[model samples]
Target: MAHERIEVDLPLAKVYELLCNPVHFTKFLERIDDVEKVNSQTFDYTTTIGGEEFQWTTNIIDNLRNTRFAWITINGNLNQTGTIRFTPLDSGKRTRVDFTLDYRTFFGEAEEDLAAFIEELPVQLKKDLQTFKDLAESDTFKDEESSSEKVASEVA
Candidate 1:
């Protein structure tokens, strides 16, 4: 298992909304090539590592709006589960994200190779979290949010 905590400049609702939608994951998650929504609570993700592509389907196990989100992979090449907790900070002006991931490596790998992968998991997780934080804080995200709100308001 690997855990990482990051504080994002966006509000809790904004952060939670982003986290709930896997379609936005490719923007921040390293190696993720695509995410396709299977349903409101399920998605298919494709990732490439070392010139090999892996695909997985994930089902949402928990989705407490503005609180926490959890998911488990199923019927895919990867076996993994993860949870992300959202905490509002600065009176809802900002958010703190606590992310935890547990995964099993592919079968048939050498013991030494598994050990090396495990050793680097935490560092990779930390970097991924930082990347997410950076994306949430970027002006592009803000502009996108504004545009979405604008479209919603116009539709209303």
Candidate 2:
């Protein structure tokens, strides 16, 4: 479960490029340390999640010509298969991305229900889009938590 939708201001192709590049995941997925291609169709990912390090493998299922792409996570706490659809809007100046995640929990786990997870997904997903937007639109990207300093002027 845990369905989320994020819209990146970048073009469909640009977003697609970022998705296709497995190595680039480390930039956003801070938990992911490295990725290696085990074969032509499989990629292994090494990540440290919740202070626990683990490895996972995923397979590329289908990919359309800048239209849709799908994949599945072979092994992990987040076992889901989803697709990303790209739609051109505003006369191709912008692109709309539709992302869906579908998965199941073992049972009696902390996060089990899919519907409930989907409900509160927007907040987290939107934040991710903001970060993605900053990276895609400009060459600069601030750390996940970087704040601007406010200096007080002497008025008294």
Q: Relative to the unseen true structure, what is the C-alpha lDDT of residue 154 in candidate 2, on a scale of 0 to 100?
A: 29
For every model shown, what is its TM-score relative to the native structure?
A: 0.79, 0.66
Evaluated at residue 51, the lDDT of candidate 2 is 53
Q: Report the backbone clash tally of model 2.
A: 1
Summarize candidate 1's per-residue lDDT along 45-121 as a digit string, tens digits. 87655555668888999998899999999867656688999999999999999998876655655255445545677
- Give lDDT for model 2: 0.58
Clashes per candidate, residues 3 or more apart or on different chains: 0, 1
Candidate 2 residues 11-64, lDDT tens each?
A: 677777766645455555333467667776677776443455556677878878
Poorest 10 consecutive residues by lDDT, candidate 1: 141-150
The number of the candidate with the highest TM-score is: 1
